[model samples]
Structures are given as structure tokens and as C-alpha cells.
Target: MHITVYGDTLCAQVTATAMAQTGHQVLWCLVEPESREQLAKGRPLFREQGLDLLFADQLESGRLTMDFWEGNPQGLTDAVFLALQPGQHGLAAELTKSLASSTSTGCGVIVNQTTGPVGSAELLRDIAKQIDPRAFLVALPDLIQEGNAFQTFTRPDSILLGCEDGEGEALVRELLRPFNRRKDVIQVMSLREAEFAKLAISGILATRISYMNDMASLSESLGVDIDVVRVAMGADPRIGEAYLYPGCGFGGPGLSSNVLALVDALNERAAEPGLLERVLRTNERQKEVLFRKFWQFHQGSVAGKKVALWGVAFKPGTHRVDNAPALKVIEALWAQGVKVTAHDPRALADLGQWAQGRGELTLCDDPYEAAEGADALMLITEWKPYWSPDWQRLKRVMREPLILDGRNIYEPAFVREQGLVYRGIGR
Candidate 1:
């Protein structure tokens, strides 16, 4: 079981480390030179929980090795995994061609975990087959959830495997046997179906979130608690609670890009305007819900005001802020001449980098420090540390005791009892 994994994505890291942990010798070919340099220095490239330690252990035990993507795999490689980022289709094709060219017998089963448009895997397979007819390409579309990526990969609820050939399916199944132990959760399908299924899953989840945000808006006008309505909706066995929370909005590399890809696919197919289009529009508007609340609370005279943001990461348990709602919120606040101070446990460094030349942003180590003398406090990411805070201290430090709960993590009545004005997405 000698596997070579390509790309510097979290999927690449997780796949390499997990396969090594399962007794396979894995050579991780990182696409980014910086990632290889950091790995050589024993520094973690990703901040996923427990991933660094496990990856380190595998490296120490000689089970996992790191190399650059520009380098060829040493000796005969049994399998290849491409976990590249979206828009790396050319790179994927190049890698498949190189592997196929180098292999005298076959390139083996090339598993594509990369996120790309439909038919991408088939295209790679066609390229590989030109060099070696035995070379097989399969699609194992990435379903890794950030923040909890390692656990989700090691124990996925189900795996979408796209393999047209019996031998390819058998090879990939053996490679993933350790993770697929619980009741055989692997759903076999055509390559195009597998890719489309992943995008459809993301689309539906985004749709649910946008739908909830839409309901939250209506709930506010009706003076009804969206949380209550959410609970009632979840009580239905048919609905089953998941991605139904009425937050400011949903943003991350995965959901946003997949929805956009789905939209593009629909458009290319000459489909009419539909739910997904509305879903994206609603989400964009929802990202500004907190900003609108602040402006309305101040009667539209919010220039030169100070606001504190509790979290900036797209979600809790990860340090990435790609397409995070906090960015939009910060931009809106800055346009209104509002000073923004933010605090997040792990995302400050990333947030600082993102804020470069965008506008003035004060990053604070402590949550209360961010809130100091601020007119309002906006909870953007709903990190666990921000769940329970020093209410009295927040009340004392802020110039105006205003709390805008974007994620509905705080109880509105309890926040008001602390003598602070509370404004949630829909309380």
C-alpha cells in the first residue's frame, strides 16, 4: 500500500496522514513550496484539531513522507490521490499524464478528491488512458468539513465513490477500507454523478441556511423567535435538524464555491432562474444583517462609531476566513466610518493578513479588549469561547451596551437582563 497524494489542500494533508496511520506508506506531494518548507521545519501547515500531532507522528514513524509536487514519486507507486483545490484542472491533468508516462504497466487507480466541475475526472482518465490503457481514474469528491476535517474523513457518515470499472472500485475500496468499516457507507456511482452529488449536497445545505435566514427576517418583523420556529421545524422527522440555524450568513471556501459552481453548471445547461440563485442573493444580503441592525438602532447616524466583533473565522474550530461574513460586515462598518476591533482565538493572524490595505482594523488578544469603549458588540463566528462571557464586564466596558447576536448563540432575555440592548438575527 504505497500511495502518493498531491496538492497542499487540507484534504491532501488529511488523506496522506490518515492513510499512513492506517498502515499505508504515503508520500505527500505538497503543491505549495511554502508548505513543503514548513513541513521540513516541523511546523504545521494546517490548524486542524489533532491533525498536526498525528501527521508529525506518522512522519516520525517513517510511515509518511513529504515531497514537492514538482518531484516525481520514488520507485513504483501503487495508488495516487489528487486532493487539489478548485480551478487546478490543468495541474491535475498534468499530474495524471506524468504518472501514466512513468508507469510501464499502469498508473494504478488515481483517486481524484479534488473539487472541480463535473466531468473533470473523466477528462483526467481520458488523458491517462492515452499513455497507459490500464491507468484508471476514479472520483472521490472531497466531503471534508473544515475545523473537524480529520474526524469527518476518518469516520465519514458516507463516502461518494465514482468508479466505472470493477477493478478501480475494488482498489479504492481497499484503500478506504479502514474508514469505511461501519456498515459499508460507500455509495458507488458514475463519476459525473459523484461530482454532481457533492455539489448538490452543498447547494441544498446552502439553500437550507439561506431559507432559515429568510425566515429569520420575516420572524423579526412578526416579532416571533426564529429559534422557536427552527425547533418546531426540526421536530418534523422529515426535516431533521441540520444547517437550519438562522445566522448572519454562511460563508467558507466549500459551500460558497460549490453553490457558485452549481449555478454556473445550471446556466451553461440553459436552465431557468431557480432556488439556488435566490439562495445566493439572500445569503449576500444576510451577511449585512448585523450592519443594518446597527444603523437602524442609531437612526442612520452611525459615523465615527466604534464596534467590536467577537469572531472573524468563517466558523469555529478552523483558522481560515475565506469569504467569511465578518469581512463583509467589517467592510460595511468601515464604509459607514465605524471603527472595527475584532478578537478571535486562532484567526487573528489570518484576519490581520486579510485586513492588509483594506482598512484600519484593531486586532485584540482578549475579547473584552476588543469590546472596550465600543458602541456595539457583534457576534459573527460563534466560537465556543464567546458562548458565555463576562456580561457585567461587557456592560461596564462598552460606551453603549448593545449586543447584536448574529448566530443567535445568546439568549435575548438574558442579555437584556444584564442591562444591555440585544439584537439577534431574529429574536
Candidate 2:
């Protein structure tokens, strides 16, 4: 099959590469300057585990090709994928219309992988069918996790497919046959239902995280460990272990936007007060938990203190910092006239760009260097390297030996035994 993937999103890159690897001839149309430059220089558009090598291999094999997005689809393309970012509805619609208007018999499936409103897929489908009777628009909402996107797409637990017609469903199934080999994981549903389900999944997961943060807060007052409670809760057959860990907060382009999209839907319908709004509120407050702890530790004398941050990315294995808890914590520290030095394995470049004109932030190449002369060390993102650090060196270099474990990755007893004062989220 000849496929054309549209957009500069991570999803677009992954889909283009994965499809090409599966014996399809794919043309990836990049809209962003960075994406086009990277591909022209024979580099993967974004860094993901194993994505670079695989994408390079596909390009070398002539299975995957790169082109600029010009609101046009290739004449020989069998399927067109719109894996665009959220809120790019106009671009998505224009591309879909262009593909549908094609006079050739090559264009068949317009896979809508972009996250949008509940009725977005249906709207695209209507526009496509109105122009070309043979064109099929199906929704396969983006469910890929950033850090582990390739694995999740290749070995998905389940797949949600939204298609109203048999021809469209069959074509999409054929396209996904290479990955959907382990006992048919695709769940067929109406277009609107699939879009709503994606948002609802994010909403429920956010609820779980916020619920655990609330429990963590209460546990601190009750003199108990949230980790112990979390383990016991996971042992139950009804409650799985996913998203149960208490942390500062959860943030990313996908989860945060999906939850907010769901909230907007509720507001549009004028629904009664619900748990999702509160869930978002709790998450925002949780982002500041580490800063609050630091302030209280010094008895309102936070000004002119130096703080070291271990990580700033939203999570490990990705360089994105959108809506990351570290951003909120940094802002809080800045408001109190605190100097912050931060280090992350991959996020320093992005963190540096985000810090432009906002305030002064020192970026360190070495994690230990970030801790030098700091009053306290705050572990915002649980990057793998941050899990185990030289406690003695941290104690020696810091003006104050205080460790604020925002992710609860450190054991309270062990940290204290290192001769450093330890403060954890629900310890």
C-alpha cells in the first residue's frame, strides 16, 4: 500500500515510519521547519527509543519518503493519515478535503489519528464522503504515550477503531494487520463513541492520579506512608496498579489536553459539577507541593535560597516539558526570590528554551553539578539517573542537606540515614 502521513507531530512521524517498516510505501509530509530540516539531513524528526534507527532504515530502503505538507496528497497514495496535533482542525479538514477531491482511484482511507472533539471524526467523514463517494474517513484516535510510543503502538493492549462503513473498517484493519496479530485487540465502535472514549480514558486516569495525591496529602497528616497504602490497594483484584503511585502531579501534551477536552465537553453540555474539574484542580495544586514544603521547612524564609532540581521534563525518555510539574515548582521558587539550578538527561535544551525571558535559570550538564551550593534538592521528574545519587557528595556540596522527593522515589528512612533531612510527599 502507498500511504501519506500528514503533520509534524510525533504521532505523524511514528505512523509514517511504522507503516513504511511494515512493507508499505509511505510519504511523510512535514509542516514544521525543524521536521523538514531534520528529515532532509537524514535524521529522525523526533528522538524516541529505536525510532531513529528504524526511520533511517526505512528511508534508506526507499519505503519511507519525506515531503513538505502543501495541502496535497500524492496521486498514488492508497491511504492518507492525519496524525496532526490537537486544535489543528482547520489543517486536518483542508488536507482531508484535498485527499477526497482526488480524481484518481488510489485514495481510499483517510485515517483520522488527530485528537479533536467528539464529533470531529464524523465531520471529517461527512466532508470526505460528500466529495468522493469512495473515500472513507475513520477515527483511530492517538493513544500513543510519548516516552514509550513505539512499543505501545506496536504491541498495544487494545485498539479503538471508529468506522461506520464496512469498506472503511476492512481497509483500516488491513493496514493494522501487522501489529494486531495477537488475538484481535481492536474494538470497533461509532466515530463519536471512539473519540469520547479516548477523552474519557484520560479523564479517568487523571482522576486516579489526583485521588492518590489526595491520599498522599492525608497520609502525611495521619503519619503514614502512601506507598504502603498504594501497594495494599493494588493487591485488590478490582484495582490495578497503573496510575496508583502518588507523585507531585501528572502532565503531558496528551493526558492534560484530553482531560481538558473532556471538561470542555461537559461544560458545553451544561452538565452538573463533576469529579473531573476537581481532578484538574488537585493536579494544579499538587504541582506546587514541593515548593510549599520548602517554604514551610525554612519557616517563611525562602528568599535568596538556592535550590537544585534533578529533572524538569514531564517524564523520563522524552524532552517535552509542557505542563510539567517542574515548571510550576520553578515559578513558585522564582516568586520567592530563589535561585534554581536544574539538570536533566534530555530536557535541558527544552527547559532552557522555556526559561527565556521568564527568569534566570542555570542549566547544568552534570546532575551533581546542579546540586552544588544548593540549599535543597528537589526531584521533580523521576528520570532513571535521579533514582540513585551520591548521597554523601550531595550532603557535602549543599549549603543545607535537605532532600525533597517529589516523586516519592526515595525511601524516607534510607534518605535520613544518609545524614540528610528527607521530606517526601506522603511519608
Candidate 3:
């Protein structure tokens, strides 16, 4: 199928490449100009897993192509996927205006690849009718993240298709058939249902993380091990472990904002998600929970404390700092007049000039340098490099050997035996 993906964002490019690599003829309309020059030179715009190889192959084959024009989108394709951001979701209206003056002889179906509110599809459908009442508008939310985008796109857990008619739905089904090689990975539902499902899934996942973090705090107060409690509880087959792993907090705006959006939407309908509200509140406080522990361990004084921090990205696999708890923690520490040195394998360079100017926040080349001269060490991210440190060097260098592990990657007893005050969530 000939596919045209609208937008120049990470999701748009990844979606286009994912389709093209899987044998679809993809022409990307990159509305943003910055990405144009790079993509025009066949440059990999992202550091996703295995995308470079796939992009190279597709670009060489002329199967993957991109355009940086904002004019009327002229294309001949069986499908067009709108992967624009939330603010630019009125793509259907823009396309309708363009279609009035420009002509595209080819017939195609339009699908919303970007997640929006529950009623966004119908709004797009209405605008699409202005161009051609036959222009099919459906919802197919992309579930991929920053680092694992390409891999996830190629092997999505399931593809949810929302359509109004049998004819429009068939086009989407056939277009996405290549990705769903296994029998039935496509599930068709109403547009509203599919949109809510995406938000609902994220909300539930974030809730679990927050719930675990809350319990982890309580575990410390009660002298109970959360790992032991989690194991016993998980064996019930009802509350299996996935997002239940206690950690600092959920990354940024996406999931947590989705939870808030759900709550607001539910309230409008005179319904309430009581547990979800608590979950969000718990998670917000939990973002600071790690720092709170760190301060308490230092006897309410972070001043003059050379604290070493590891991992800046909200999660290990991604370089995104959106709603990153580490950033907030670092900023708070800096405000408190504490000496903070940090290292993130991927996010170090991307932290930008503002973070660079901070005299308190010193960026380190490696983990050991960050840990040097530190009264206390904090683990903000669960990167593999930060997991195991040379205990002898760590023991010798620091004045105060307090290891405040947020992710709980290291064994408590092992670090404790090294003459360090070891602390972790629910340990």
C-alpha cells in the first residue's frame, strides 16, 4: 500500500519508517523544516533501537521518502496516517482546505495515529467530509515510546481500529495487515471507546506504579519488605507484577496527564474515578518521595553535601526528560544550595545550556566521577552502569557513605556490609 504520514515529529517519522520497512511505499510530509534537511540527507533523526539499519535500507531502496512542504498534500495512496501532535490535530480541517484547491487523483483512508480526546475522531470525520464525504477518518493510537519506538511499531502488542463503516474499516485492516502477521492482532471498536482505551491503559499502569511507591514508603515505616509482600501478592494471579515494581515515579506528562484527563472527562459525565484520583496524587508526591528520603538521611541538611546522582531520563531505555522526576529532584536540591554532580549515559548532552550554567549541578563524564567526594549518593535512574559500583573505591572516597537508592537496583545487605548507609524503597 502507498502510505502518506503527516507531520515531522518523532512519532510521525518512526511510524512512516516502520511502515516503509515492512514493504509499504511511504511518503512522509514533514511539516517542520528542521527535520527536513536531516531527513533529506538520509540522516537518522532518532536513536531508537534498530531504526538506523531499517532507515538506511528503506532510504537506499527509495521506499522511504519525506517532504517538508506545508502546501496542499498531493499524493496517490491507499492510506494516509495523521501523526501530528495534539495541538495540530486539526489536520483534517487543514487537509480539507487544501483539498478544495489541490487535486489528488488517488483514493485513500485517513487514520488518527496520534492519541487525543475520545471525540476527536468524529471531529476529524466531520472536517474530512468537507474534502470528500468518502474520506474515512479512524483512530489508531501509536503506543511506542522514544527509545523503543521502531521495535514497538514493528511488533505492536495489538492494533486497535475505530471506524464508522465496513468499507473504511476494511481499508485500515488491509493496510495494517503487514504488521499483524499473526492472525488477529487488530481489534475494531467505536472511535470513542478506542480513544478512552488508550488513556485508560496508561492511567492504570501509572496507578500501579504510584500504588507500589506508596506501599514502599509504608513498608519502610513498618519494617516490612515490599519485595516479599509483592511476591506473595503477585502469586494470586489477579495482581501480577509489571508496573507494580516500586520506583521513584512515572516519567513525564503523558501517562500522568492522561490520568488527569480521564478524571476530568469522567467528572464531566457525573462519574468519578476515586482510586485514580488517589493514584495520581500519590504519584505526584512520590516524585519528590525519593528526594524526601535523601534529605531525611542527611539529618535535614543537604547544604554543603556533595551528592552524586545517576540517571536523568525518567526511565532507563529512553532519553526523554518530559515530566522527569530526576529533573525536579535536581532542581530542588540546587535551590537548597546543595552541591549536586550527575551523570546520565544518554541524556547528559541533551540537558541543554540552562542545566549547564548551574554551578551546583556538575555534569560528570562517568558514574565514578559523579560519585566522587559525595556525602550521599542518589539513584534517580535504573541504568545498568549505575547498578554495580566498585565498593572499595566508593567506600574510600566519600565523607558520608549514605547510598540513597531510588530504584533499588543493588542488594541492601551487600552495600550495607561495605560500611555504607544503604537505603532503598520498601527494603
In candidate 2, list every pair of residues with a backbone clash: none
lDDT of 1 by residue, 9-105 (tens): 9999999999999999999888877786777887677887788789889999999998786656445678899999899999998888888888443
Off by over 4 Å in 3: 33-45, 96-102, 105-107, 271-274, 353-360
lDDT of model 1 at residue 81?
95
Q: What lDDT score is found at residue 413 in candidate 2?
A: 90
* lDDT of the structure predicted as candidate 1: 0.91
- lDDT winner, 1 or 2: 1
Q: Per-residue CA lDDT of candidate 2, range 151-234, in tens?
A: 888888889999898998999999999999987999999999999999999999999999999999999999999999999999
- Residue 97, model 2: lDDT of 87
Worst 10 residues of 3 by lDDT: 96-105
The alpha-carbon deviation from the true structure for residue 248 of candidate 2, after best TM-score superposition, in angstroms, is 0.8
Report, for every candidate in turn, its global Cα lDDT versus the true structure: 0.91, 0.90, 0.76
For model 2, the superposed segments whose C-alpha errors exceed 4 Å read 37-44
Error of 1 at 368 (Å): 0.9
Clashes of each: 0, 0, 1
